[model samples]
Target: MKMTDIEKQVGDFRLRIPQLQLEDGCIHGLIGGNGCGKTTLAKLMMGILTPDSGRIDREGLTGREITMTSQRPYLMHTSVYENVVYPLKLRGEKPEESDIRPWLTRCGLWKKKDQYAGSLSGGERQKLSMIRAMILKPKFIIVDETLSNLDPDSVKLFEQWIREIQEQSAVTWVLISHQLSHIYRMSDQIHFLSQGELVVSGPARELLKNCGEERLRAFLDRESLDRT
Candidate 1:
C-alpha cells in the first residue's frame, strides 16, 4: 500500500506528502520533528483525515483491517482483561479463555488483568493498548509513538514482540517514533518526513549513513547522543 502525492491543510499549514510505498510483511518507519505532520499523514493514511486531494492505493492490503495505536492509549471503561478482549468481541469472535490470558502474559500484563484499565500506568496502558490492537489480527498496524512512554526494558519487550508478530503473522507494521534507534532497529524500510513532506527514505542504515537533510541530520545527532 502507498500514499501518492497527498495534501491536507491543518489550519494555515499545508501538510503535503510525496509518494510513499509500504511493503507487506516489512516494518516501515515514519520519523520527524514535532509539527512535521507525521501524525497528520498517518491519520490521512488511516482514513481518519480527508485529504484535500490525492490517492491512497492499497496495493497489498485490503485496507479494512488496519489497526492503529497512539502515544496515549485509551481503554474502554472496563478491566484490563476486558480491554484486551474488546476487539475480539467487536468482531463477533468469541475469544476462548486460552486466547486472552496468553496475550496478556506476552504483553506482560497478565498479572494486572483484573485491574481497571484507567488505573494502569502510562507504559502499562500503552502496552495493553498495543496488545489489544494485535489481538484483532489486523493486516496493517500503525503505531504512533507507542513506545515513547515505556521504559527501556518495556520497550525491548515490545520490540521483541513486534519481531515475533512480523515472523508469525501476515501483519505489516508502520512504526512512528522519534526514537531513531528504535526506528533503526525495527524498520526494514523507512520514510522520513519534514514539514509534512517526505525528506528522505531508503534502507534504515543507508539513511543514517547519508542523512544530508538538515532536519534529519540533527534528529540523528540527537538520537545518537541519547543512545550514549
Candidate 2:
C-alpha cells in the first residue's frame, strides 16, 4: 500500500522518489505535466517494472491480488462480455452475467456487451478496461490516466461511476491525470509529481487553496484560464 525510497529507470528517464503511503479508504490523485513520471510510478507499484532501488510495500497484495489500468488501455481480442469477465476468470472464478452487468451498465458499456473489445471506441475501451480492473474488487487499484483519453461526455459518465464505486466498495483508488478539473473533482488527496519526484502531497482541498509551489500554482492557474 506504499512505496519506500523507490527508484527506477525507463529508457532515457530516471525516476527517483521517496515512499508514498496511500491513505486507506480514500481516492488519491497524481497530477503532473507530461514526462513527470506519473505513469512510471504507477507501473512500478503494479510490479510491471522492477524498482532499481528501494521497494514497494504492499502489505495485502501478493502479486495475484493487484490490478491496474494504463493510459493507453489494454483490451483482449474478445467480446466485451469476455473482456469484462477475464479478471474473474484469471482468479479461477466463474464469470457471471449478474456480476458483470452492473459494472458494464455503470461504465456505459452494457449495450456493447457482445461486441468485440478491439472494436470499441477509445472511451468505450477505457471503460471496458476499468470494468476489467474493478471486477475483481482488489484491495487497491492503480489507474494510470484512465480518463484522460475520453470525450467530455464519456468522462462525465466515468466520474459518476467512480463515485458510485467508492460509495459501494472499500477499494482504494489511485489515479493519475494531467486534467486539473478531474483531480479537483475526484481526489480526497493529491500528489504532485515533478520529473519523477513527489514534489508535494496533501489534502486535495487545502493543497488546491494554498499549494505554495510555483509549478503547482501555474498548473492551477492554467486550469482556471482554460475553463474561461
Candidate 3:
C-alpha cells in the first residue's frame, strides 16, 4: 500500500506524510514516542480514519482483507473457543474443532478453550485476540502494541508463529510499538515518526546503524540507555 501527500489534523496535532510505501509481504515497523501519531497513522492505513488530504492506495484490498489488533483487543463475553471461531462464523463458515484446536494449542490456550474469555489474564486475552485475527487469514494486518502484555516467553512464541505464517503466506504486517527491541527484531523495514512526521524510514539494520535524523538518533540512544 502507498500513501501520497497524506495529511490529517486533530486539534493541535497534525500528521503529514509526503510519500510512504508499505511493501507487500513484509513486516514493517511503525515506531514513535507517546502521542507521536503512531496510532493515528495506523488508523489511516486501516481506513478507520480518513486523511484530510491525500490518497491511500490499498493495492485493491477490501475491508474484509484487512485486520487490526490493539493492545486492548475486544473479546466476546463467550468462551475462548467461541471467541476464536467468531470470525469464521461471520464468514458463514462452520469450522470444525480441528480447525480451531491448533490455534488454541499454539497459544497455550487449549486448556482454557471452554473457559470464559472475560476471565482470562491480560496476556492470555492478547493471545486469544491474535488467534482470532489470524483465523480470518487477512491479507493485511496492523498490530498496535499487541505484544506489550505478553511475557518474554509468550513474545518469543508469538514471534515464531508470525514468522512461520509469513513463510507460508503473502501477508503484509504492520507492527506499531514503542518497544524498539521488538521492532528491531521483527521488522524488515522501519518507519520512525516524530512530532507527527515521518523522520526516517529504511531497512531496520540500516536505520539502526545510521539514522540521519537527530531526533530519532537521540530517541534510540535513550532507549539503549534504558535497556542498560
Compare the candidates by TM-score and give the number of the best one. 3
**lDDT for each residue of candidate 3 in 9-79, tens digit (9 for 90 to 100):** 97899999988999999999998889899999999999999999999999899999999999999999899
* lDDT string, candidate 2, 65-114, tens digits: 67799777877888999887877877889967887788888767888899
Which lDDT value does model 2 have at 36?
A: 89
Structural similarity to truth (TM-score) of each candidate? 0.93, 0.91, 0.96
Which pairs clash in model 1? none
CA lDDT of each candidate? 0.83, 0.81, 0.90
What TM-score does candidate 3 reach? 0.96
Report the Cα lDDT for residue 165, model 1. Answer: 81
What is the overall TM-score of model 1 with all chains considered together? 0.93
How many residue pairs collide in each prediction?
Answer: 0, 2, 0
- Give the C-alpha miss distance for residue 31 in model 3, angstroms: 0.5
Off by over 4 Å in 2: 225-228
Best to worst by TM-score, what's the order? 3, 1, 2
- Model 1 clash count equals 0
- In terms of lDDT, model 1 sits at 0.83
> 47, model 2: CA deviation in Å?
0.8
